[model samples]
Target chain A: MSWTMTRKALWDLRWTTFWYALGLALYTLLIAFVYPTFREQSAQFEEIVRNYPEALLRAFGIEPGQGLSSSFGAFMHAEAYGFVWPLVAAIFVIMSGAAAVAQEVERGTAELWLSVPESRPRLLAGKLVALLVGMLAVVGVSVLSLLVAAPLVDAELPADAAAQLGVVLLDFLIAVAGISVLFSSIFSERGKAAALAAAVVLAMYLAWVIAGLSERFEWLRYLSIFTAYRPREALEGSSVSWAGLLALLAIGLGSMLASLAIFRRRDILV
Target chain B: MDSLPIQVNGLTRFYGKTRGVDDLAFTVERGEIFGFLGPNGAGKTTTIRLLMGLIQPTRGSARIFGLDCWRDATAVKSHVGYVPGDARLYEAMTGAQFLDFLAGFRPGIDPARRRMLVERFDVDLSRTIKHLSKGNRQKLALVQAFMHDPPLLILDEPSSGLDPLMQRELLTFLREEQARGKTIFLSSHLLYEVEQVADRVGIIRDGRLVAVATIEELKRQRTRRMEVAFSMPIDLAQLASVDGVQVLQVREGGRWVELGVSDGLPVLLRRLSELPVVDLVYAPPDLDSVFMGYYQRQEAITGERAR
Candidate 1:
């Protein structure tokens, strides 16, 4: 609601947005350039995938003997979405979210902001909105790279693949950012907030990996936020669960609301 | 006109079991320069924070402009311009940009006033905040708080990093604001800073209101420090036995005796003239001696009488 506050937040975090977006675009370009070699060696790679251990393939979210190398979207899933995008989103969320509140407190700058006539909710909302815009830019660059690279390789990414990748990637980013902001709101120390948020994301990733390797631990997958985004399946134009997407959206909104509730009543130590 | 700019009644804040400020009740008239004085960790910042609505009171309430500080914080804050004890400006932006960003929130802030303040502070508005030194940053904060020209100014340790000249400039600026009928609440641990401009002062110690008096009243109870170097060693008991003279220190085998005299200066002077004296010096009173005199349970000055 406060455009001035939002503009300040964006200006403060412009470099962070630029670097993350650049990294995603470069990584996507690398994968696109290597796609031709992967397509030529598809048969051999398929044989290798078939012979690979089932547990490892499941952990990597790759179906054994499938046509992963045959499609650029599927290749992107196994190479980027299965891990890289989530990791990037987690790091971005942790840094920006902590900077939103915890960094202000530690540096004793929140006093200046809170002394103004604006309410706490409005200030926080503007910061969070700016962060969301940054995340969108990062993911948008990745999508643009894929669209630009696919035509040069004589490969077409299905419309469904492009749309689903953007949606689910954004969903995942929002969820992780919400959790980061929640922790940032609770702690006055930015380092502590970032550390806790990172630990939670890593723990969730580990839970999903371990749970995928065995049937007995399958219940752990539900606890991981990453489980809600089945990017590979979504790219294949199958198994796109609206329920899962909604769950992720709900997590994002819920955590943000909780942060607002606590931040409104809590003392700003700075 | 508006119910005394600040009214705090039995305001107390407890950090869990530890007290931040205890049973503090005070009021500031509409245009008086009220100084809240205390040592470090004596709860001056806590009181400021509570009034700013950055923290809630554990026991009582603070009202500004007749509105509850907690429930109607936005309304209360709209009338107040505050400078925190440790002000950290946005280091990435130029001073002009930071001031512009602050001015955007308040509708009544005039651009001409902002320009005037920037010129008065003599800070390079084009330089990034990180490039500015500590004193320059303080000047930036002062410009931000004063540019808006709010009716009430709550400043905590406002002169901490300024050079002596700038400090004097700030005192003069505050006097001008006072002339314009602004209600100023200045909090400081340094006694002399408050004494220089404060119309009234409230001394807090150990999370309690120890004393509150006008500068005139506090000066009335002040003691003078006297030192004498005798031609020969004299019995120190002669000075210690006086009604209002207390021996503070004895140096050089009692030839030099430092004394704190509140009421018996004449009697001590009479006795000194009778003894063999080589050198005598009288030092004007400092706040420490005045505080020491009051700390020893001399006539207790209470805020109630001032109210």
Candidate 2:
């Protein structure tokens, strides 16, 4: 990858990265601040969670046998990691991947870029590296915020919970980034790329929810990337599915390579 | 390097079933300024994009410096500087930053030349691109293209948004690049601009190249307008007999006659000199009229072939 191009891509995304990191960090801190109440009223919270219907529990990303007041880490996973983190990271990845090529084409900047000596793959690799860096930086802010707010809320997290959560978030981002890049590679408009990626992510989440409602729909879980990221299972024990994690990473890598190939052969419509 | 800096053979492109350019074959020699001229949607930009390897041709190929444009585009592009028709700079970046970003893509770009171009174009590099006017944005594009000092320059509508003074500066710069042995392939619809700078011009119409000629050759083919006021009325039959001269009108009761002269201007002048003892005025054809002449001729030929 060309560092010059990578640096410029990162520089171009600086403001977006800043705002995303800030927002995610604030959300993590809010969860940390509210952890104390859940711990104190554990019985009441458990009763309320048990009374909810099974489909409603699934919709809220509440796994079977996992209570909201069981552990600080479990509470954090349900409140932030289960749904909010994936959504936020999906937005970040969509924007980054869409801006990678489609946005440039829409703004007519791709013409200037392709006119240079850099090969198409090199250009794409640089942008991908930049995006990965941005995602990591945003996740780093959440980790830092969680660590800083833990003591204030009198909460206890597993020693490696932050690191495990970081891995899960990274996996989520890379999976969505793959879809984003795939859509961006096909469309010349950033709006179209972002919209398609958002639709796919939302559909995947709904597929997982709808699948959990009945045994007949269980097959739909395979269609949703969320199935690969069981944060509740990861928080309870060290039982994160290595296969699922690898699958998420593999999907991202596979999609990225496919995007590069398509971009190489396709006409830049600017 | 090949003596011909550019070589395109049977280049064709289609967007679905719609033709972009068809069977385009041309060559641009070293140090020559070849102008690709056509009105909007006539496939000028499509051909340029093919040469730059920005888009693939449906059939046929384009080569630069003897390297296949698509297969060896990275190596070919190392020696080419391009100014696209749409000059879109990163809005958040200052002009200086934008140039720097482009320069970073190529390893051998000259800082000295970049500075010179910045000064020559009279652009304020300190301001963000969003704040710059259209003309200033064009200046920044020109600077980035020239700063690399490549052997070949492909400019598509390079002066679209520039003011008259900046346009003149651009013309001067192009001439200087030619003197330094750079190959230039510029596309434009502005007849006068092409006529002023192009050594050879290719006119495309409806996705086909209709005419290709040197400036002087095109001038020779264009009809010349003339008006002659004779001291006395002469035999209109004698004037009509002159080769390639058509009488347009007889004003002042046949004392003054307007004529269109094509190839035999010298013969027409001689015939007029024998009788016009009063006055004469001649207007050489403008580039627009010359351009139209080719289009009309092509239509007539197409019509005849249909018969």
Alpha-carbon runs more than 4 Å astray in model 1: A64-69, B224-228, B235-244, B263-286, B298-307
- The per-residue C-alpha lDDT of model 1 at residue A148 equals 84
Clashes of 2: 0
Quote the lDDT for B53 in model 1.
93
Report lDDT (Cα) of residue B31, candidate 2. 95
Worst 10 residues of 1 chain B by lDDT: B296-305
The residue-by-residue lDDT of candidate 1 on A39-157, one tens digit each, is 89988877877787876776676755563557777877888777777687679878998778899988888889899998888889989999999989988888888888888887777
- Report, for every candidate in turn, its global Cα lDDT versus the true structure: 0.85, 0.85
Candidate 2 clashing pairs?
none
Model 2, B141-252: lDDT tens digits are 9998889899999999999999999999999999999999998998998877887899998888789887888988777666666788988787888778886666878988
TM-score of each: 0.93, 0.91
Please tell me which predicted candidate would have the highest TM-score against the true structure.
Answer: 1
